[model samples]
Target: MGWIEKALMRANRWHFVHSYRTIIAREKRKHPQDRERALMGAIGAASRADFAAQGDAQVAVLRHHGLSDGMAVYDLGCGIGRTAQALLRDGWRGRYTGADILPELVDHLRAQCPGFTAIVQRKLAIAAPDATLDMVFHWSVFTHLYPEECFLYLQDIHRALKPGGRLIFSFLEFEDPAHHTVFQTRTANFAVNGWSSVLDSFLHRDWITLWARQIGFAPPRFTSGSDTADHPAFWQSLAVLDKPAPA
Candidate 1:
């Protein structure tokens, strides 16, 4: 790209960040009395039913991808224990830890699902020891992060995972028609209004595969967002990257 194009991109990003912060501030003002509500809104879950439904769908996806008992698992960007609660209800007997950037979400997760380890994640790093986890997954987390941020998280996830461990996360892509709606809405908002409340990032399969390979993971597996036979409500495209076990 030319220098002028690069400069324009940076300016747009700065505007989006400013608008996002403004929207967040407005939300905070709207929910001064209820931190939990504000946090839930930020994550796009409006009510307990909505949250539980989404959690159930996430649990289904995890199970479909071979989530078995006794595996040490970490839920990155684990907002308010959505999947954790579902797992607990299903009598999941495994070592589970949940982490998120928001302390209120972590605290609420702890309160909602006692005995499950939930911590406030300040940086784009996992707290677990190296090679200790069986699986690390996040739903609707990477869809909002920049490409570089996603790459950084992948590097840390590789460090935290055991050999042959998996990183499963949901994302958005332009290849899927269902996802184009999200792209259209966000882009239209930005183009017409000059800013949008949320920043929606999209990734391509080729890019993700390249990143995974560069980070020493096996070729990543992708699931279409429209494939909802298993998890009806979870529509975001999913990717699974497994750390290669030693020969």
Candidate 2:
């Protein structure tokens, strides 16, 4: 890209970030007591209703996977502690670690939810030791990642997870023909810097299972019909993978 194009992209990113900040500020003022609302807006939710539904959907998925109290949990791309907040509200006693790429969101979460640990994860690696975590949930994370990026993170996640550890992550599976048409066109000319544009990357169920198997994980179970997000970035299909423990 030329300097002028680079400058334009920079400006666009700034505008996008600034617009998000403004909406968050407004929501914070409107619902001063509702920290979840503020945090959801800070991350990407457009409205409090959407945030609540999405939170409930995520919690249901966790519960369905047999996640219970006292399990060590990691939330990848844990924007503004949404999953952390959900877990807390459900009375989970897990050791929760929330990691996100945005420093400001991480800092805010560190201050807001002092009980849980939050980190600004610059790399694809999760900050947990090998075979330590009971579960790792990546909400709307793989949606933004390219195939190579997804593979790198999956490798790291496999290293961090314990035997029998569960991995739950979301992706956009192009089941709809209309969506597939657009997804194919965008991915053909995809670029990393255009995350906001090319972030809705699609994945196939067979590919997910293959990737999981390649990384020593059991064949992944793909589920759809999760609650929808107002934002275009959040994917509807979720992949659940389990690390095999020694017999």
What is the model-wide C-alpha lDDT for candidate 2?
0.76
lDDT of 1 by residue, 69-123 (tens): 9999999988778899999987889999998766666888899898899997757
**lDDT at 102 for candidate 1?**
60
Task: Report the C-alpha displacement of residue 68, candidate 1, in angstroms.
Answer: 1.6
Clashes of each: 0, 0
Off by over 4 Å in 1: 1-38
Off by over 4 Å in 2: 1-39, 176-198, 226-235
Q: Mind giving the per-residue lDDT tens digits that candidate 2 earns over 76-193? A: 9887766676676777787889987767678776776778999877577899999899999988677666677789899999999999899998877777454475466665655544
Taking every candidate in turn, the Cα RMSD to the unseen true structure, in Å, is 4.3, 6.3
